[model samples]
Target: MITATDFITIPYTSDLTQAGIAYACRSLPYTYDRMGGSHFNRLRRIVVGVAVELAFRRRLAEEKVPHDNLGSTPFTDPDRYDIAIGGRRCDIKSFMLTRRSLIRHVSREPQALLGADALVPSDQIVSDHLNDEDLYIFAFITALTTPNQRSLDRALKADQPIYLIHPLPKEWAHPSRWIPLGTLALKCDTSHAVTLELGGQNESRAFMAEEIVLEPRKRAAAESDFYALGYLHTSNPPDGIVGVHSPSVGETHLVEPIQWGNIWIYGMQIIFTGYMTRGEFRQRGNRLPAGSRVFKYSSTRTENRSLPIAELHPLSDLFTQAKKWAKRGA
Candidate 1:
């Protein structure tokens, strides 16, 4: 249950329920003009999360497994959960769009709770409770979307929701090994607090939550960090590509290939022909022909290529280079 005023605050918490509620309160009734893009996205995520939880509860019940919705708890408190076929303490995460599973993202921040390493300097510690836990079962519910925001906007307005659900990131490194599930539950010991583990490879060390604080060091200076957008040869691939385009009538189309479309960059496969949407082509006015709204161009994968500029063959190399430079805000 999200309140109206919650929209004003951008809540960033590791907790699933809180984040979902905050996102929904801030982002629903999404209109292109109303603004609050982050909030809208958050709402979508939260909705998906709820669906996952319900489904998990139902399945576990059928199997006579015991489980609780930790997400349904209060904002300030950390909800403890357990998954069981017969009231056992099994750890699991629920997903709505695809298969049943969870993917937990762990990175060291300045300070946080529940990490083996101290979250240095800062007063708070943000540890991923579910960092490495075995589960009774895991699942995912993937909600797919139209390539660009505009199409998605139209679809949402029409009240048609779309999403894709699957097991792993197709074709990339360790496909099965890379599960894109959200954090569902962390298995804890006697007390409600999460247990912290430590180990480089084989052996293991352990730490209590109260014993440590972890912090992050400032990033080392670098000359430049170049972001290169990669594209597959074909229009429709298992992992779709996302490009930025403006839909205004006179605006030029600045169709830029995304490095990783829709966040999942690993092992996305695309065929030989490049895919360009009608709205996207319209945005790059001069570059794309007026009547010829959609453009599909493909390029051969070269041995040592710089960027995916070859795909935009019609345009002059200089123009393409200029577009790339402009994108970098240079």
Candidate 2:
């Protein structure tokens, strides 16, 4: 059983977030959601992934562990490997734990968060995913239960229990505070002019309701939590899995996306649950047919595989092993 102790939370700095967003933006033209989903959402995912890779690299250095930085961003340029340990290449896959999943885990006393799945999209599982990588590190990022900390503060101030967490992001049954421009076009009156801003850039611009069409821009003006990284300005595609919310009211609905990717680039935390190597994963991972529900985003894109968080080797074990490899190499 994986205890909470095995899960290490690394909070990132503004500089890291900025680097991640810049990398994501530059790579936006090259990389995309192979499954044919929201391109805006794809940018958010890439940002979160790079953040995790960068943070983990810093952690390895701080611990004095031997490793090689493989440049986690610019998506497909060199290869899929993010970093290497003991000459072993690693590819990191990120998954978002739904708000409902978080709440359920919180309520269960001493509950081992065992069932969280590290997702691998089906098509990428072949050409996109480099099978030669020595290991796979699956990390999970979370969203604030409420729209923002203020919402949580208001609930606590009123002496009320916070129970408004929904199961999936961008769900119609439980609408997220963050709505993307495309989704907003569908829901809100677009005739009125709306002002928008990029994540870190100063000054805002006005968009006619009609101009707020749903699509990914080379660059989007959004209100990002990191200030440096900025916000994810896109349509919040309604789905049963992970979602990004609209921007806030004071920020003119410039809600930072709480989805796995958006949060970190916009200054959110991610947890390192555990890891498994490619050979072992290929041997043990459960094969899910195309369109199987996996975590926040449904893997409707193609057939994919998944492994439970509980089944992964503890990060401590990985670190300990890395230390041994360093000694041998020395």
Candidate 3:
């Protein structure tokens, strides 16, 4: 049985370095195109995979457990697994828990077929590539809902737990191609038939009558205190200052600015940063000098405060410093 001892925790830190940020800004446009246009949500999903993989690998290394990382292997390869431990192939499946009690299905396909016997057996849909000898590890992580930069920074620094389940038998594994029971019974168009190749024969099937009722099962698990891993920050400091802002009070407050890159760090944990058009800045609130640009420090929060002219750095200087830092890191 999988126990608490089997799990490992990996810390999360801001990986944004001067060079990394510079590279990201330069290449993100091309990368987004190559990833199929501006699908930020899709890109975020891929990043979660990367984070989980890295955390697992780090834990293995720390425990002195010998394992081979096979993530670079092509997905089409039958032997592809996330890691190999003691010659046992282990595949990692990760999902995000949006709420305290639920996890939505990852599969986008319909779950049931159209007929008197509409429930599709789970075994038929399981991938043939997964060998019987291979073990499955499911990693369920928490999702953050920070609305502002302050909250985001705090969430990133805070220790979040990851629940893991292991050795899930291949026989119990379900296919990602499953449709909702309600959709299958009521909304499915009878005229549109689905073709399936089964047992060396091509079969075309049409939707059943609306009177058919198939109950949908809740795939998510209840809350449990499983083994969890915590994310910690690395030794390296932040790449650059994003911006600077102070809390709004009746009395004027002195602002202290620390420059990192194009952004400024101030008030200890808060980062001052954001871009706005000259017209928008003037029309919305206070205006700076005619040639000067204005950047909102607390853009993510409801309370707004403007940086004093003396505390503000020229945009040109920030870019130059960022370039220098990038080269130094390189």
State every prediction's TM-score relative to the real structure. Answer: 0.26, 0.59, 0.30
Better of 1 and 3 by lDDT: 3
lDDT tens string, model 2, 103-190?
Answer: 3563352134566566665555566455544778877765342344565455457564322211112231112333333222112223
- Give the candidates in order of lDDT, highest first: 2, 3, 1
lDDT of 2: 0.52
lDDT tens digits, residue span 66-162, model 3: 5667655432222335675544455554443343232222112111100001011123114464444443443434444332346435544764221
* Model 3: how far residue 292 lies from native, Å: 56
The Cα error of candidate 2 at residue 139, in Å, is: 0.6
- Candidate achieving higher TM-score, 1 or 2: 2
Which has the greatest TM-score? 2
* Local lDDT at 74 for model 3: 31
Residue 25 CA displacement from its true place in model 3, Å = 13
For model 2 the TM-score comes to: 0.59
Better of 1 and 3 by TM-score: 3
Clashes of each: 52, 23, 22
Model 2 bad stretches (over 4 Å): 71-79, 98-112, 124-133, 144-267, 298-300
